[model samples]
Target: MTTTPAPTPDSTVAEWDHVVVGGGSAGALVAARLAARDSGTVLLLEAGPDQPVPRDRAHPLADAGRLVLAGFNWDYRANLRSSGRLEDLLKGGDGTGNPARALWERFPYQLGKVVGGGSAVNGAIALRGLPRDFAAWAEQGNPDWSWDKVLPFYKAIENDVDHPDHPRHGDGGPLPIRRTPRDRVHALDAAFWGECTRQGVTDLPDLNSGEEAGVGPIPGNTVEGERIDAATAFLSDARDLPHLHVRPGVRVTRVLFDPKDRSRAVGVETERDGRLDTVRARHVILAAGAVGTPVVLQRSGVGDAALLGALGIDPVVDLPGVGRDLVDHPSVVIWSRPADGVCTPGLPWRQVAARMSSGFDDDVDVQMGLLNNVESHTIPGFVDRLGWPLVVGMSVMLLRPRSRGRVFLDSADPLASPVIELGLGTDPEDVERLCHGVRRAWGFLRSPGLSARLTRTQFWSDRMVANDGVLRSGVRHIMNPGWHAAGSCRMGPDSDPYAVADQEGRVHGTENLRIADASLFPVIPSAPTNLTTLMLAEKLARSMKE
Candidate 1:
């Protein structure tokens, strides 16, 4: 059993039983689960405002609808490898010769700023990764992380409004998920899936039924048209708990480890309204996501020993893998010309996705999401950022890749955006794999079911789609991430050189500290990270209690 240290005579720092950093998607789960038990007090801290201001009082900066281009993002940049510096944006360069080059010399990699993290602003597509995806993690030395081991957590977390009667689905859960009725969903989305069936893919009416390796309508984490984000679903109950305390607009600058017991994490140093404060806790769980979690570790001297020495910070744990092995689903948008029909304004959360095994025969390694909006070709909605009035589009994505990127310090400042080297398309296999999906996407749009409804795209010239070689180059050039980022603080056996955490999500060489966010993923799941992230939080919470 673990012993609780006695308080010192002059101890004046605020203390809690557990201090959970970040209030994003994963953070909400941590806080909610901890506060539910009759355990000691739990404290949650968020970098953004905590209040759920009604839409009427929301400013443009704080607005949830416009999450991509708005100020509610930590816009990190992925620089070109040619210059290999963040300064490449000042003097722009053209395309890279190899598929191993940067998609954009300097493109904005946006991360959520609001309390619910990506869930508050994301497309709301709820998907679980393939079972094979989790099985791979078990092979990688995390046995408990196997798909079978964690399937119960996945089932328990969802309160499926559509498949509530399904044996695999749960009836009592905070996160409400619903399958869109056929009449409510857009025709274009329906046609795309219909064409997939014509192309030899069996129509998967319910993709989340543990057999999701086919084309289907995407389910969403929405309750009656409103988003049931992590904060909305989990934090509401947490807010009512007397033992739970939430502090918003508070940024953690550095983690506080015990000086005598260097491996023991005690609390964190935070800045709120420019006022510095020290809050101590018996345990600390960093759910600050893939990007934010590693930053905290590095800043607290748990990262690369040489880098910390250079930064004038004393090394605590000297773990070299603090911010390494970053992974994301690199995507490229395929736009068809304005269709014969006009896309109705303010449609419901429009999302449709498909999973296919590009390399393997059975297991899915590639997934594609089709969009019906102008701006996000990333996360589409009624909002339009592009000048093009009408278009049918799809986000072709390489779900799993051999490429690995990194998150390093831009400066010593805590508030600064970390230098995110989005190492996408770094491997030659990634390009070829994505190129094949792009060709498939083009072919699907050209099918009679899809092509009959659309005009040709104005964006693509003959040169861009001339042949396979040309399309491969185009895929490499236009590829971007699907905003599902993970694997910065990788989890594995401690023997792994790159592992930042053990199989139980505990940081190496430290006690009373664990990571429960996407950062702990050794590799990103083959689905939208929202559901997996919540399940991860539940796993960590239950494991710690046990």
Candidate 2:
């Protein structure tokens, strides 16, 4: 890849055919595709500095499970108070029946600030969200986003090593997808799967097949132990293209509008090294992620008219949905000590996960997966918090939570962090289902196969399960982000007042503006959103070319 210095903010206004913001998962791929197709001169801007992907075991990013690393993460925090009624119970207001004191406060929200975005640092699970996920998008008046229509994009974006010849899988795509071999799978994972079978959870070979839901090998995007993120997969070949300019450490402050025709977007205003400058572009695509994208739009005077006006910003578009309907996978973990022979540093971070329906007829709503080792397991200070040198974990996640939250601007400053409120467990059903998942997990842990491989040093006492109220309190204190955020900027027809953009990712109220990111999801998918985000970039890039 070519190394080109970012243009100085004080220099003459740089112009390009398209200016894509945020070089994370989607932006990198979009810019690469446009440039490789020779669409036009494209300028890609990223707020974080670029770093090479390191494969050595000594590096922080070497293990996909090492997600809590400090330097390269956005480190956004969210208010996870599900409701006010549970506040007292969470705070230990009741005299009894609370397992862990409730921490109903702002919790950490992880997003990659690096070039490859989350794909660079996240657990590399390559999941194609259930087909019904797209069907729901189509139901929301986005016909082009239907499962049948979007399946082609999904197929064309992956090079599945295990299922290359399968009709539904792709063999020539840039991103690589593979699973850990059965024989090489960790003992803990094998035991977990054995427990899954006893629980009547089917063992499917491919989780992404969309045929059946059960325990299966995790499909990850990795090559020789190194993550194949968007930057490595999409930008490697397109970086040398004379037309594409990748400008790291340059953050786009807001989208610029035509002075005369305020409804038309012209380009963007950017900030880098404390200097501010404007860049001209024929079109501006907001690939700034769900949180970043909505913040950008709000800063640019394109959110709820009242909210913008209260912040003394002129309203460019009166779309009230810019930062509403925020959704993320809310999860809680049950930690235990691994068997004497387990927790080997050589073992893969994750191997098997159970995807099953909590109650839905056709949809898989929950995910229970094993983390072979906790984040920063190799570090002493970090491991001290969990009180274990090395601990295995089973994360119970609500894949399709009914609760919805938001990311909104508390300050008009472009660089100011937005307020993130994750309304997790706001829906009573959410809490109930999570409690159910925890019970199932407890059963698995107590099963003969898993019991032999895991120690009884548990994060929470097994007796807590008998008390529903106490179990709910435990859910409140321990529930956290699954690191998958979406739906802040939803796509729908104009008839739907909350719709910010159309099916093609075009902003409805403005001209020459578009969005290509997870922010466009109408509903959070029933799986990790990494692969689906890449599929989105591939489809949007092709549409832009056409």
Candidate 3:
């Protein structure tokens, strides 16, 4: 896809009605919709290169096998070690019996640097957050985000090919949603589902149709093996709009304010090709993802006054919650050896998954994905020594975690990546719930159907699963982020002390400035956040026009 070149540095005096920072999933759609409505001239800026999206051949963004392609990611690292208990558990003395410190060290965070953000690089699972998930947001002072109110926006973002007629699924929208046919389901995934069924896990044909608890083929935003992400969905046609300008490789540093009126945002300062420039706008919207948005806000002096003061930044807005309350699904995976001939040709890597409530009385709080392969250095060397083409892994994720973390600036420089400390296992309940999920996954691996197709013994030894203390240790050791980060710039009412943005996405203390991305989530969703991020943009863009 082609876009207009960015305006020259001196062109900062040329005013745009709306300037959007970050050409990610949310920002791309927001700019497209606003421009389409003739509301204003919209300028979308991205720090990464405008990657070539070719329909004729396979591309990394288009192929699930090349999910995390090199050179297209922001390459952020997160410190997951949060508590003293965790430190004690992971600390090694003389390096004798305990797993190496590297195993429990920092995790690599995958934030998309390209135009489509995560939608360009993610696994493309088109699942929605549970209705209860939105209800909780409403309860947190964002009544506009209630499930009933946001359902229309969700419908407006997708054209579901598999269940277009279903009341909950949409038929006409920019993105296409489809699921793998039962006959074409990967052999390993099919076995997983069968095992789940025997253990009373519901056999769900459609996981996104009102009911979320069950095992089924995942609905993805893929058509004919190519990705139709936000850029491909919204900006592809909107690029023709004379008012819309999607400029890649322009890195926005901070929102600019009127000199006299500190509360009013007038524009933003950006860096491109080692040249610093300013771009004036009547309104500035921050759709940078959870990590990028908070970094921009804090850098612009919109975070805790004390923190900003320490960094020598004059405070623009003293919103202490700007980078607080970071949330994500804590996850772990158990690798198993596949039986002979199980890794057949044409078998998909990950096409089926399960969401279970497990021991919890609440909504489905646990997610399980069947992975045919995972070539990560994080895994044990013994597994790699087996010499199989791919090792089977059952990943379990805690959907609703009570633990919270932070995203803060390591330096005032816009080019510097922020320090992300995911306080995983900070809350004992999170660890306890994850342990329960792990035990359930262990049972699934041992079930007749899966055992017949793979070795019952997993990389996480039977001895570890047998002892409660050992199981808890294993849970802490193997836990990883779900790659669904949110709540860094949460939305809520003025009454909420931690609310950075109100229900309309307006930054609490700044005029003509708003945020539309995963950062606006008061709480992280139970499912993959890509679809929800698009829905948020569709809703926020319309609200901005009104």
In order, the Cα lDDT scores of the candidates are: 0.74, 0.81, 0.81
List, residue by residue over 1-546, the lDDT tens digit for candidate 1: 332332333433357788899989888888888878745677788887764644332434223223344555666665522324323321232212234445454676667777888887776778887787798888888998988888788888888877877777776888888777766667777777777777677777777877856887788886555666788788877677766777778899888999889999989999987888898899999988888999999889888876666556788987888887888888777776555454643355355677776543354667775667443343432235455565567767777778887776645676666767767788888888887777667777777766777777645555566587787778777777777779999889989887999988899999999999999887788777889999888888888777
lDDT of 2 by residue, 326-402 (tens): 88888877878776776776457878988876543445668998888553354212234545667777788988898
Give candidate 1's error at residue 257 in angstroms: 1.2
CA-only RMSD, every prediction: 5.1, 5.5, 5.2
Residues 189-215 of candidate 3 have per-residue lDDT tens digits of 878887888778898998887687898
Residue pairs of candidate 3 with colliding backbone atoms: none
> Each model's TM-score, in the order given?
0.89, 0.91, 0.91
- Candidate that beats the other on lDDT, 1 or 3, i.e. the better one: 3
Local error of candidate 2 at residue 503 (angstroms): 0.4
For model 3, the stretches where C-alpha displacement exceeds 4 angstroms are: 1-13, 53-56, 83-105, 344-347, 360-363, 373-383, 456-458
Worst 10 residues of 1 by lDDT: 88-97
* TM-score (C-alpha) between model 1 and the true structure: 0.89
